[model samples]
Target: MKIDENVCWGIIGCGDVTELKSGPAFQKVEDSSLVAVMRRNEEKVKDFAERHHVKKWTTNASEIINDKSINAIYIATPPSTHLQYALQVLKANKNVYLEKPMVLNSIEAKILSDALKQSRSKLTIAHYRRVLPVFLTVKELLESNVIGHVSLAEITIHQSKSANLIAKIADNWRTNPTISGGGYFHDIGPHQIDLMVHYFGEVDTIIAVDLEKNTVSNDVVKGFVQFKNGIQFKGNWDFNAEEDKDNCTIYGMKGTISFSFYGDEIIIFLKGKQERYQFKNPMHVQQPMIEKTVGYFLGKNVNPCSIHEAAVVTQIMDVFCGIN
Candidate 1:
């Protein structure tokens, strides 16, 4: 573990997500380079490496894991394969960057947690929102009492069944419980919960939650959760809703703040003086977090996000999904 010239990156699963949501950031960020990439499809790997200008590409993950030049491994595969690839990356004595919802449930989380504890390499999760400028600005706003002392919080995420990323799956791998570990609820639920943890604290209790699934619509989940701060909260995630929406409202003693989960705008309603602040995310949304990870490995900063943090996301999600 030497603080050397630059951090080299090896990406596993150079598929859809890697195209622009993250691929270019390895090179776009300062002092980090995507030296290698791997995918199950040879044609896709070749195209990704060539398009991203990565020096090497391979169909086998072992090639990326074993390459001496690759000091960091980015696991961009599905949730089911996160733990497996993470273990392999750690076993190779390289730092690991894992996808969100670390695993299916608390059971799988414990397995990955134990492996991380045993490994010599460092580990981080891709809760990219934690590094997004919009979220960070909101954190500052809350801390500065922009909305006064915060107390109650409410979240509502509803959308049409067939218009989302998961809906586009060909073989429909995203909704298949066996391959994706759950339906769209489990797939897209992590980003929301993980960000809540960042704003509030650990989820203390899932008071009560209900899950409804049907053939013609997106599944619906309704639940109430309490954070460590005793913040009373209620949230609903319904893919079956007729209206499309993504929103979270935090009510303070003085006022309220509302914003969308995947958008770049925040609205503050303080004393009826409404204000809106907007910030655009980078083309590669993961770049800021990836930059922080590179800095962590270079020994310049603390770890940004951890497997345990993502484990908490899965842990809470399991309760809402009635898994545990």
Candidate 2:
């Protein structure tokens, strides 16, 4: 079922990711507008509303969720609050644009899945990169077999403890396992893993282990994914490394394709020739996905990213962190 109406949005957490990455896209998308925003900090929320030209701001999340005018709610809060707020939004008959790692664990994913089944509203996970041009091009190249019969893939992300790649928050909740799930792996792995699942199909088996354990979170995580398509993927994430490095390479019978998940360039190598492709992300990185989401919300198109697709990523992270 579709809304058949303009998508009026209420932001549940107006934090760093919303400043430019996604907040403005709600208004920029056709037939969609950000009507209100909510944050625990009254001052910050008010400031954000005034600066963004939004009409309403609140310190209470319920105010935004219960607002009759808000037909959709974007939950940008940490992983811990995702289930509570998402359940409430669905119960209120409001559509949801949930942030990634959809839930902390498979248990929460199941609970949310059940709620979605009983609700009339729709939910889309924020695995926004799949819609970006660079990734789409990579998907196309792989589909065309530009890299021949794919056999193996490697994903390596090594960053120093103070890596700028890691978003800095006041409370540092991202490193808190109870809040962000595992650690840097849980926070960043979903984006890469979701793309893997998007590029490949489903997972056949997965095995992961933590290399360095800390009270807050794991500093290093290594995992292997075996896809049913007969492709094997090995991934390693190190938060306490000597330097910063981010790249994923897919090897095939003919050559290989290498690219960075957070960057705009894609490179393909075949024998002696090397081809490069570059893309410029929109000023608002999430705008493209937001446009797609708006279209899906109004029944103009199919869901871009579904809860089930995102649940698979969470399940992978669970294994990576030795949760089960």
Candidate 3:
């Protein structure tokens, strides 16, 4: 069977993520090629192009969006800038691989959803966790009924500091309620919430508490969501923790599944037998996301995480942040 030609990729906001991280993955995926990159700083864009062996570089985001040769665009810009850039790319009729949290709230999420529907441009959110090997294994195990009926789940992500490069990029935008939508809850909650909704189903109700305010507003948030299946998911994010923790525990009638985000390893204890499973990190997590998203855009026989699911996650997050 003859394979279709690789899809040419253009990256908007070529920063640290594009260079040390996702940029390399774009080149690594078999059916995808990094053709062009854009950054406001010409020096950064040039350096990225040279390091990645990309043929084209531009300081203008629109240049990449408008290039007929580029079939897909990745928006790695800050959450604050996601909406405008995404709209421009959609107008240009290019598939979009958007960074996580989709957008600030349901309104922006709705706007982007409408744009995708109207333009019929392929859209995929970069909720990389959904594509991780361990997480995928957990999903499969849950569906396979090794755990019987899932009754409750707890997901916790504890980071020592909130002030990182991405946080700095989002500094002004993150603090401002107008731009960021909310703080850590809006930023990182999408990942955990996506997993919860994916495993369970629609959320019926949610209650949240945010304990901080500032540029990195909401240092901590704890909330519970009731899924349509009557399963309860309790999630917590503590930006002020001393050590980082990214793990989830699911409880069911027959067993429990526990896993961490960093290692892509899962442990299942069912009816007294303990089983541990491990899988290689697929494309460093983020790259597989890009590749799968590209395949979805190219009409290949691969399924990308649904934007409607992401929007629901965002909606749950909005409620968790008390935004609406």
RMSD of every candidate to native, in Å, equals 2.2, 1.9, 3.2
Global CA lDDT computed for model 1: 0.82
lDDT-superior candidate, 2 or 3: 2
Candidate 1 clash pair list: none
Q: Candidate 2 at 37: error in angstroms?
A: 0.4
Candidate 1 per-residue lDDT over residues 1-324, each given as its tens digit: 232578888999988888888889988888888889999989879987887788899999999999988889889888788878888888888998888768767998998889878888998888888889888988888889887778878888887855563447466777777767777877777888887887887778884464554222227777778887877678788876787888899999888989887888999998879999999998889999988988888889988987777887877777777776
* Candidate 3 pairs with clashing backbones: none
lDDT for model 3: 0.79
Error of 2 at 298 (Å): 0.8
Query: How many pairs of residues collide in model 2?
Result: 0
Q: Which residue pairs show collisions in model 2?
A: none
Segments in model 3 whose C-alpha atoms lie over 4 Å from true places: 1-5, 162-180, 209-216, 242-244
Ranking by lDDT: 2, 1, 3
Candidate number of the best TM-score = 2
In Å, residue 320's CA in model 1 sits off its true spot by 0.4
Worst 10 residues of 1 by lDDT: 209-218
